[model samples]
Target: MPPSPRNLDELASALLANGPVKTLPAAPKRIRVRLGGRYVADTTRAVYVWEHAYYPGYYLPLDAFAEGVLSYPGSGGGNGNGDRESGYALATLSAGGVSTDRVIVFTRRGESGSEREDGNVLAGLVRVEFAAVEAWFEEDARIDVHPKDPFKRVDVVFSARPVRVSISGTEVARSEACFHLYETGLPVRFYLPVTAVRADLLRDSAAVTACPYKGEASYYDVVVGGVDGLGEIRLRDVVWYYKNPKIECAAIAGCLCFYNEKVDIELDGKMLERPKALFS
Candidate 1:
């Protein structure tokens, strides 16, 4: 995704088994990972390694590793995998009784384990799986999902265009001063103010999700179809809002957004096709 950027779903397609791979210069952001309440690496010297995922993982320098190195850079050390002299600086990381079980190694591109890669740019670099760590941080803010892709962008713009949403022919929400959140690789979200939504129909949902670009989000379950022949139905977690969003997306705070795929939506009186993506 260096020359031409593509979304994660494209890489997940079975037809595209072997695809184009690219790398960029080391990013300037100070990325840090925490394991068992201890900081793993807190440095700006990190490279974005985009492999199977659309968003890249941070590959920090060898020095970024604290005293948590169990085995590395030596004679046929155990890489949590049963192999010897793989040419990769395989390591086991442990802190506060938490450890990586399998496939936790600082790998080089061209080696016994990763011979398919013909280069050594990824050699001597420590790439940690996010799930193996307790928390990941960009500066001080906790990042969820995965590392934010530099190529991807999120923008919130105030718009006056009329927006409307209907569920099973029942008008749910209509707004004139809604905000449009355009996020790369996702469908555009129409974030309407709370006053524009039907608060009586909305019930608090237990679902919560986090984003690296946007902050933690709380959801709402909208109840509909309580009149005529239709039975009363509760659509679960179909709407969400970020009470406190990341600084870059502060404009979307306290705004309600419906799942464009779950409900019928119209913008400026024109019907909009339901978007197809992971959210859909």
Candidate 2:
């Protein structure tokens, strides 16, 4: 039997895309979990499981956790079937001065409201909620937001393409040197120099966001003055910069990049058409 195509319109492109592969016990990586400056879980044998199409989750063997660190506060009801058939039970992961509640501990429980079923692959494995932990590490480096996709790649290229930016018919920036950031499944971003932008129009914003591959980024709101009898416009967090980007994108540090969807961008002498994306 033939497999159903995921996307009918882009059949050729979809055919070239990466399909799910079965890696027994999943892909290996040294994953460590920390809470309140204390290491609660550390394992060299950890597998990556994709709960969503965007990012993968880490699942470690039950023994990887330190003794007495994971405590089930009781299901409050389950008919006292012991911990084996608890299914997904609430756990209090506490160590040192740190603790978190509502942490799910996946056990040998079945999907239905029943006893532990045999042949369940997740029987002996422990599923830790990534967000519940204070920090995660791959070996020694600290990871942020989420785990890095092993299949994804980010490339930074130095381009001499002359780029100009405008907001509401008001020309804001023009630069001949722009670093092009190309990430998997994302629109190409043109990062411009600070001198190329109009300083008077920029307002420092308190927004900050982190990326597993690119470190933390600070934002700026571009406020354009009234034009052609139109009121002043404020584009919130329309521009962002990385002061200390990760090594892979170190070259683009301190460079500003505007949200192409919120502003008009011109490559060379031609205006670029706004691309439809998640942020758009």
Using lDDT as the measure, the top candidate is 2
Error of 2 at 247 (Å): 1.0
lDDT of 1 by residue, 1-280 (tens): 2222233233222212442255565557788877777886677877787764567767676666675444443444433222224434435566777766322344433334432243445544565767667888888988877778889999999999999998988888999879999998889999999888898889999999878888899999999876763688888999999999999999999999999989999999999999997767
Model 2, total clashes: 0
Number of the predicted model whose TM-score against the real structure is largest = 2
19 Cα displacement, candidate 2 (Å): 16
lDDT of candidate 1 at residue 110, scale 0 to 100 = 37
Error of 2 at 219 (Å): 0.9
RMSD of each: 6.0, 8.4
Clashes of each: 0, 0
Worst 10 residues of 1 by lDDT: 7-16
- After superposition, which runs of candidate 2 have C-alpha atoms over 4 Å from their true positions? 1-27, 75-83, 110-121, 227-230
